[model samples]
Target chain A: MTHPKTRAPRVARIAGLVLVLLTAVSGCSSPQKWDLTNITGIMPQLKFTLTDQDGKTLQASDLRGKIPVLYFGYTNCPDICPTTLATLAQALRKLGAEANAVRILFVSVDPARDTTAVLKSYVQAFGPQFIGLRGDQKELRYLTKRYRVTYGLGKADAHGNYEVSHSSAVFVFDRKGDVRLLGRGTDPAKSYTHDLKQLINDN
Target chain B: MQRIHWQKHVSISGTHGRGSMMLALLLSCAVANAAPVPSVVITQARVRLLPGNLPLAGYFTLTNDGSAPVTLTGAISGSFKQIMMHRSFESDGMSKMAPVAKLTIQPRKSVHFRPGSYHLMLMGRQQSLSVGDTVPIQLQFKNSGALTVEFKVVPVGAQ
Candidate 1:
């Protein structure tokens, strides 16, 4: 009787220890809940070839060490583009110096109108971390097709003014150039700040 | 049913505070045809200006206190060379802005012109504007004449 009783207690104690260890292991490996959509594995890695504001060609590998946020818009967009860029600026402001690790890639879909000079001035107004990228129709197609986004240009009016429709999705990639989070222009600045901090801290 | 709608309006007014509650009462009275056509009041008018002569966006709240629905045709401003009413919409992650010909506001209802929705696209600045400066914009309405409202200019990130 004594032997059976002692064995039973020992087994129960062992099971309890195993349970605690299992809980701890789960706590370590569980995925974090991101404020933005956690698209860690849903999309392909970041890849692009576009001209920077300085008219220098750059590739995805060139931005390997920093977090790159890709946004497609034109300089002439009166409301959505500016508002979205300003919101991202606000998020970076919340991050303070940590924002240096972040680079907002404003890719102009309307290269016909957004020349390098126009893009440079337009993006520089947002912040130093912003980089205006322009690509030819072929290069732009390659990049947009890779992400499965679209852009359309409307018929130009008499004054050569036309409407532009582009992807409002904000693609956030980590330092390794792996696409991770997906955000929208309508998202609150706090959401960007929150997810950006996580992406920056993530290994 | 009428009592339920009135209670719902009261609840909505509760969230908007006392001034809105009074407006709600005034709107209810107007809706009952107890008063003449109430003039539309403009509130919280502001313009978001960008740097380097880029276009700007104007946001405001229009309260239609009249019993009849009012149609807002367009807006004009001396500060800008062109003003058009545009609505920003999102579909399948695509952001698109299109011109709106007219907007009809129901009786005793309010229309809010805000970001990601109805806005005044002010382009071609005729005069320079800085933050905190107020610019006058005339809002034209069909069958209701025009009302000049002063819109305070705000920074790009004001929203």
Candidate 2:
């Protein structure tokens, strides 16, 4: 039979374990103070099989250990796409060497116009970390639907030019490929830099 | 083109009791002879050139200094085959661009064409353009004559 004094110590030990477990659980549940919209666990993990700028098949696992910042746009887009990419470039510039671990995935919604060659030069202008991806209608639709984002191509004009409308949201995924933050094309560069630094440090 | 020049001296300091009154009177007089003042002044004109022959966005501010409002019908550039005015906006969580047929600037007011706002979409490049190159784009105005403005080509990262 255990002594009463020994039983008391066992009860205390069990209480201590419970306290540590509670702290861990709360830490996971508590909201992180991010300048951008915190989307941790609210969105699915980054999963897509698309054609990279080099015309090679790219799987999500290829970027498993790197944080991916995904944006939907087209090469012909004059305003929003370039602006968004430039904004991300500015943010990454603030990260210094830390920017090496971040990859920007620019998925072209208008795959018809944004060919592999066009997408390659387009993203390379922004930075070395930028990767332009192109997918067919089925692949694009599936990936966009998974993220609850929508993209539409306007009617072609007489010159065979058209407009492509897409979501401006910039999705930042963690190193584990889990979506963590949602930002906009109009957000200041500092906001992205702040969240990216925190995310990089955390993981 | 005839230009309006302000010959009258106007006080700018608020500490003077008659500064506001004098400025108002000067403006009234200036409006009477506003025909000599340029109807539209284009400032901070720049073109953001993307990679390849991708469509570029032109940004500038059109300030109407005349007494009458001026309408910008369109723009044309020898370097680009097609130039269309477009406005970028966010609606329902989507970033969209809509073609703007005509944009009117009120008298003494300014209209800014910048990123994520009113801009000129220049497509189908007829000639190669690089950073620091200047493209002369004529701004077509309704009723008033067109004005040739030089838009400096900037890198994609330029806002």
**Which candidate number would show the highest lDDT if scored against the true structure?**
2
**Mind giving the per-residue lDDT tens digits that candidate 1 earns over B1-159?**
001011213233357888888888877776555322336878889998777776789999988877789999999988888899999999888999989999999988999999889999888899989999999998888876677788999988788
Give candidate 2 misplaced runs (Cα > 4 Å).
Answer: A1-31, B1-38
What local lDDT does model 2 show for residue B105? 91
Candidate-wise lDDT, in order: 0.87, 0.90
Alpha-carbon error at A188 in model 1, in Å? 1.4
Q: Candidate 2's error at B150, in angstroms?
A: 0.7
Candidates in order, TM-scores: namely: 0.82, 0.83
**DockQ score of candidate 1?**
0.48
- Give me the TM-scores for chain A across all models, comma-separated: 0.88, 0.86
For candidate 1, please provide the TM-score of chain A on its own.
Answer: 0.88
lDDT of 2 by residue, A126-195 (tens): 9999999999888999899989999888999999888989999999999999999999999999999999
